[model samples]
Target: MKIRFPMRASVAACALCAATTLAPASPVAALGPTGGGPGAIVRPEATVPQPAVLYGEGTQVRLRSGAHAVPDVTALSWVVADAASGEVLAAHDAHRRLPPASTLKTLFALTALPAFPGGIRHTVSAKELLGIGEGSSLVGVVEGHTYQVADLWRGVFLNSGNDAVHVLAALNGGWEHTARQMEDKARSLGALDTTVVSPDGYDADGQDSSAYDLAVFGRAGLRDPDFARYCSTARAAFPGTEGTFQIANTNRLLTGADGVAPYPGLIGIKNGYTTNAGNTLVAAAHRSGRTLVVTVMHPQAGGHAVYEEARALLDWGFAAAGHVDPVGSLDALRPVPRGATTGAKPKTAVVASTGAPRPAEPDWTQTGTIAGAAGLGAGVLLLGLRFRYKRASRA
Candidate 1:
C-alpha cells in the first residue's frame, strides 16, 4: 500500500532520484586477485588482517580446491561470520577501511532507529531537503508531503534514498548531531574502522568502513524485527505528493533483477556503490539452522564481482560451520542497563555506545507529542545483501 502522499494543493514533487554518488579520490594499499587494477590498494599477505575464526581443515581444503574460486576482483576485501555465535569464519583485508558508499546507512539506521515510531507522521521541510547532496539516490519525496516514519524507512532500505535519511536526521535533531551520534555508535559496536562524515554515505572526504564492521552491522541490525522487515521487503510503493510509485530494492541479489537468481533462503541486508567505494555489500543467509553474514567491499564496478565473492565466502562458511574454529568474536551489543531496556522486543541485549547522545524527542509509544514540532523534536531517537557464487543476503 502507498504511504499516501496526499495530492492536495501543496508543494509539488520534483525529480527524486537525482542525487549522485561519491568517488574515491585518494589512493591506498591494495589487495586483489591479479594484485588488483593499477594504483589499487595492496597489502602484503603477512600484514593483511585476519578474521577471528581460523579456517578448519574442511574450509582449508575448500580454499585449496579452488574449484569454486574465491571472488577474483582486485583490492577486494570480505569477511564471513556466524550470526548467532559472533564467530568470524573467514576474512580478507577485513579491517582495512575504505569508502563505504551507501552501506554506511546501516550504521545510521542503528543509531537512529529508536527515536521514531512506525505510526509517527512527519511533514517535509525545505530546510531539511537542503542537506541532501546532489547526485544521491532518492525515493521521490516532495517538500510539502506528510509521511509516516515507516514510509521514510521504506525509502531508505528499499531505494537507498538520501532524501529519506535526511528527513529522519532532521526529525531527530540536526544533521550534525545525528552524524555525531552515529560515529559514537560505531565504536561501541566495535566497528572502529568507520568514519562517517556524510550520513547517506555519499563519499565524503574521509567516510570509511570495513567489511568486518559491515558484518557487525548486519548481524546486529537483524536482531531487531523492524530492521529485518525493512531489508526483506523487495518492493513497495513509496509515498509521494501526487501519487505513490513502486520502488524496488537496489540489492540485485534479493530481487534477482540482474542475471542472478533469487538466492535460496536469502533474506535482506544491504548493497551500495560509489565511484570511490566501488560496489559494496553486506548479506545474511540461512541454509539450515545456521545464519551467516558476509560483507564485501570495493570489488570491480559494473559487474556482479562483489556478490560472487560474497557467495564464495558463504559457501565456505556454511561448509566450515562446525568444522572451522572461530578466531574472534563480532563484539556483542553493549549490554543493557540492569533495569533499563532499549524498547527492543524479546529484549535483545544492546547498550548505548559511550559518548553518544540520546535523542530527546517523544515517540508514538512515549507520548502523543510529534517530532519536528520543536527543533527536530528534542530527545527522540530510535533506530544488504548480495551474493554468493550461488548465494543470498539479509537486510
Candidate 2:
C-alpha cells in the first residue's frame, strides 16, 4: 500500500530547507581553526536577540556608553532618536525649518492610512492625472486606470509617485482640502512646526518642516507595518494598459552596494532628496533588540554619505545604551523636596490667611456706642470748667 503526506506539509519542508540554505555563513565558519577548509564545518551567524518590547510608543532610547558624535553633513538640521524611548540621542539644529521634499509623504501616508482600507478599489481619472506638472521622479500612473487602494499606496511610497499622490488626494478631496488635512494631521501628531502646502512634496514655497518633526512623523509611519513594507521595497510592479509597469524605489538605500545592508534586524522608514533639501534620509535600524531612528536633512553630498552617518550614529547609540535601561521604571523618579540641598538653610513657614471679611453694614451698633462715649466726655469737661469759673468769681 502507498502512503502519502499532505501537499502542504511537503511544501513546508522544502521551504524550510531553502531558508536554512540561504542563511548567512558565520565568521568562524568562514575562517577555519587551522585556516584549512576541508575539515571546517560552517555555521550560520547567531541571530541578534531583540528586546521583548522593541519600541514603546512615543518613548525615546537612552544613550548610556558610546561616543555621541554628530556626523559631518550640510544638513541644515538633523536628529537621532531612540525609536523605543522617544529619547533624542543627538541633534543639530533639529528644530530649524527646511523644505522636506518627498519626506512630506510621511504625513500623506499617516493621513491616508486611516481613510482608505486595504484592498479597496478606486478609479483613477484623467482630471486627477492632468496638471501634475514635472518632478524629480514619478511612478507613471496612467489616467483612467482603475487600481486597488493597496497598489496606489505602493506607488505613492515605494516609487514616490507624485501622480499617485494626486489621485489619492483627489479621491479623498481636492488638493487644497487634502493639504489642509495633512497640516491638521501633522498638528495633531505634535508636529507643530510643520506646514504642508502641497499634498505631494513638490517644490512649493512655504511647504516646510523641521528635522525633529520629521523624526516624530517617521516614527508614526513606521508603526504601520504596511507603510513600512512599502517604504522598504526596492522595486514594485503595478498593472498598466500595455503591461505591468515596474518602478524603481527613489530611495537608493534599499538597493545596490550603496544601500543599507540587511543586518540582524533592519526596517525601513523613508529617504528623500531635492536640490533644496540635498540628500535627506530617515533611517530606522534595529540591532541587539534596540531600534534607532536617525534623521539627516540636507546633507552636503549624496544619499550614501547620509546613510553612512546614520549608521555610525546607530552604532554609537547601541553601544551607549546597551546596559542601562533608564526608563524601566521612570514613574518612580520625582522632583526632590525644596530646601533639601546640603548646606542650605531650612525654609521658614509663615502663617497667612485670606483678607479680613468686610463689615456687612459698617458696624452700625458699634457706631452708637462710640457716639455715646464721646457725648459723656464732653459733658464732664463742661461741668469742670463751670466749677472753675464760679471759684474765680468768689476770690
Q: Number of the top candidate by lDDT?
A: 1
lDDT of each: 0.70, 0.65
In the range 124-155, model 2's lDDT, one tens digit per residue, is 88998876846556777787777888888888
Superposing all C-alpha atoms, what RMSD in Å does each candidate have to the true structure? 27.2, 30.3
Candidate 2 stretches with Cα past 4 Å from truth are 1-68, 257-264, 322-395
Question: Where in model 1 is the C-alpha error above 4 Å?
Answer: 1-75, 332-395
Clash totals for all candidate models: 44, 10
Evaluated against the true structure, the overall lDDT of model 2 is 0.65
Q: How many backbone clashes can be found in candidate 2?
A: 10
lDDT of 1 by residue, 14-91 (tens): 111111111222223444555556666665442112333322222212232323434444436777777766766566
Residue 159 CA displacement from its true place in model 2, Å? 1.0
TM-score of 2: 0.63
